[model samples]
Target: MPTYISAVFNKDTRTVEFTADNGDKLIRSGGSLAWLLNNPGNLRPGGKYAKMIGQADTKSGKFAIFPTAEDGRAEKRALLRRKYNDMTLYNAMHTYAPESENDTAAYLAYVRKRSGATDQTVIKDMTDEQFNGMIAAMEQYEGFNAKPETRKERIVHATQVTLSDGARPMPATPVIVRSSNTGEKKVTTNEHGALPTFITRQPGEVIELFLEESGKIGSRIGQFALQQASASLVFARNMMTVGGNSQPHTPTQPSKEKRTPLRYVVQPGDTLASIASRFKTSVDDLVSNNHIRNRNRIYPGHVVWIYGKAPADAANDGAPATPTRSRQASYSVRSGDTLSRIADRHHTSVDALMAANPSISNANRINPGQKITLPVGVEAVPPSAAGSSRRAGNSGNPQTSDRPSLVKPPPETPAAAVRPPASVQARDTRSREGEGHPIAIIPFSQKRAPWVEHAYAQARKWAGKKEAEISRTINFHSELGYGKQFTTLAGSSNAWCASFVNWCLRTAGYAISSPHPYRARSFAADTTRFSQIDEPVFGAVALVGTSHVGFVYAMDRGRPVLLGGNQSDQINFVRFNPATLRYYVPKSYLPFAQKELKETKLDELAATDLNAALGIVVAKKAGDNTR
Candidate 1:
């Protein structure tokens, strides 16, 4: 177990990664950590993070922390460091803080506009239902009146309507009356809860009252108001049907009073399940509230709010006082160190660093420690500061131009960044080959992982996660290229095939970056998606070479009939021969993994061959977790 204290000088919304005493890199988002840990999903002094209203200090500075864990830590810290390198660009340079009333005013207006209720325009063109109801009411009463309760049959099916609460001259609400056998009619409370709700009499009495209220006619205007009221009533009834809503209107900024149950600072290797257990909350709540799709991943030095935590209990836990938030400053530099290396240390990306340090030249050169002006927030420091180590301390460097230029450092290839994510796995698998017969002759389910039984669980899980409306099939687009270099990226293969399948899964939301938990390309489409797919589904890959990509259709003699790319020419499905070629199928190409794979998007891969090659059927391996 490792425990140490450290301080943060500055930060941004980017996820922060730091080495634990065990030399394991832990990560947590600069923005989410600061926001979540402070209150941990509550409105109290420590948990209230309602909305990010505005940026102060204009720079919107950031803060940071010292990371430690291992009283039995999580996954390899190298992996945490890897995560920082892979998904650095998913964050913002500016750390978020609570919004002020002024910031909210404009947004509130925007919300109202989107809701189609800025001016309270009620949908009120009366439909035939209302007109017919009025006619029925007229026909029912020959002369006298009775209350709804007494003459329930008369108006039992009439759609109930309500009067606007803000009606002027606010008299007591009128009562409702229906025709009765005697001269005396029965009355019930009005829709507004007052007495003598409505008058019920013969046509002569109704006309007389109408004439008295309005000399000419009252039916037209009264009917319109009734229609308006009914429309409002119906609309209100249907309000609950609005889908995908977190709140009725807009979510009011979270407050200390309605704060999260507990606040947790991410330890290295902490996954959603681990933290949820610590706080006595379900993993679902944690992921759902935080919008975290990947259950296995979490960054260190970040804060999390257990929205389900109870106040008194949280207080009993003696959580820390609320932490303040700030912004961050950035520096762009000229060519000394490639952006990859620098971004890695900071747990960010060259693209992000560039965005933060806008004034710096993007042309990529920087002298040592040249002040490139950064936009960052001041990180929260522990009561006692700890030791610091990194490539630091360079001042005074010559700048040839006035426009923002990057601080140039000596160029160095970042091994962590440039190295392929699964390179080690690939190397291990390749080492097992006794000797290459031709060009890497290997059997299916041999060498490395055969992508068989081990992937079943992930495949099943992914099937469940996909929406029914979207096509259940998988597709592959092999656009190979290399802008995303010198960064630790996830999923996919370095050269081809595997990366393509990984890319599709990431786009579909089934995958999320994680040093641990689980991932499977074959099941990456949806965690819950499983329904005996019939057609060769969309987005599936059809590979041609000894290696190819394709989507599966019906089983032709047990072979996965598929649609895919490349044999000798155009894109089409040929067949998969396990005896001859190696085909890579993935279950989950998490977001970070796909983002990394996207870096190598190829314009075109090998052409898909249609001429029948050889296709073989493989049975499910025993002991596979089908669910």
Candidate 2:
């Protein structure tokens, strides 16, 4: 079905129906008026009342929301940032749409209406892809390149117009016809759906805005006055098949002593964190070694590895050394993984990935078996890391996955002919098809109920400024989207609640990486996020085991509540926990987390300072071991 934007500008409303990509949902239909207040970007998906569920699900693109007041230079800078990030994310992250192209504008008004800016205090909108791309590009400049950047075109208006019945400017005769530099005639209207007759020209041509109303002189709306659009990235081959995939990425620290091997054929309900603790290792070691596709979807009979077993005896008499030092080892590249995703799998921040693989571009792509070096940096803090699972004899990695362990009939499985390695993936599974082809995670539970309210409030807050929320909401309801840690462990088809919350924070001007999925729980963004919480931070990204992924407005009882799309039935607020309080088992395999937005973008928001309001620090502890 087609969606229409019955939007109003300057006290007039019109309904313009355009084709909406499959997953784009109409969460909050726009009204006749919206106030321009606080950080508009904060009002993105999972943030504002007027939102869509996800990105537009295009080929590849970027969105950048500047304050409608930001001058042309700043908007350009933001676009540059998004463009750089797109180079990485469109290829790496597992969003709904990947590897597609997109166009960009400084503010929503640029696309929705032909509004010009002049130090105006009016509100505007942007998208997650726009913010992610800009930040990714910035991170690359700062030497953090595991993730990709955003890409978009300089805004352009065709040198054309639609013919109107006549130009009396009444509700009925609202359109007008005008002549063009091409010696051709074009038409425009002052109708409810049309902008007033104006001749906005392309570069090297001419434009004249013959205002039907007096005192409305017009000029160029964008640099179409004198600039060419940004260039698109060129590729030589499929990166995986090309030589780019096998770059020699080195670890941050020098080689450490050999760690023991911990092997487990997945048992029923076994999780990544549980296996890591059982072998006295870290989640990172497990993720690096295992190359898990999604942390929440481990299956029974799939072999997962940890560090505890001895090396093969060379002479059949050699004794195994103590495994305490190294504790774990692994294959870095996996199918469908990028540096950021890989970093998240290991529970480390993106900076750590850059530290280890300095040679990889923050905007670069990595291939399966890319031989990336892992860092033995910060230790993880999963609930089971304290040994409760081992005491129950449930710590092995090879647990019985519930996903129909009997191998599917040869024709029934897509990867069957390939004999996939257990968990440790190393190929690209992302595709262009949406709704019909999506990735999802298990639904982990949190410890509290009110988390849902908090999550909802937070999500609405971000949606106010972002344009992606509508699409994300619509997609999730359609089985084309996916979040959080508890859900990761509790079980998921491909949950991205945590990822959603993280997206929110980033949109609101916080720098964060995606959390590793072996996680079981998480909290709201605060100084503690970079410090206590061991994961990424982005507005709309989820915290595991916290409630489901959505928005994190604030924290209560050390848990995060969320407002998200597609929990069981619709998009709404729900409390979640990292301590396994609740869960939603997928009834059947439906495509999920499918259509991603364009690419990484810049144009971040200025998030409210939680520390000043609540008197708590928001960054990592002062003395913690960090890279």
Score each candidate by Cα lDDT: 0.26, 0.28
How does model 2 fare in lDDT? 0.28
lDDT of 1 by residue, 177-253 (tens): 22222222222212121122121222222211110122222211122111111011100000011111122232234
TM-score for each prediction? Answer: 0.18, 0.19
RMSD of each: 36.2, 27.8
Residue 268 of model 2, lDDT score: 30
In TM-score terms, which candidate is top?
Answer: 2
In lDDT terms, which candidate is top?
2
lDDT tens digits, residues 332-413, model 2? 4657655544433333433344444557543235788687655432222222121221121211110001111011111211
Sequence-dependent TM-score of model 2: 0.19
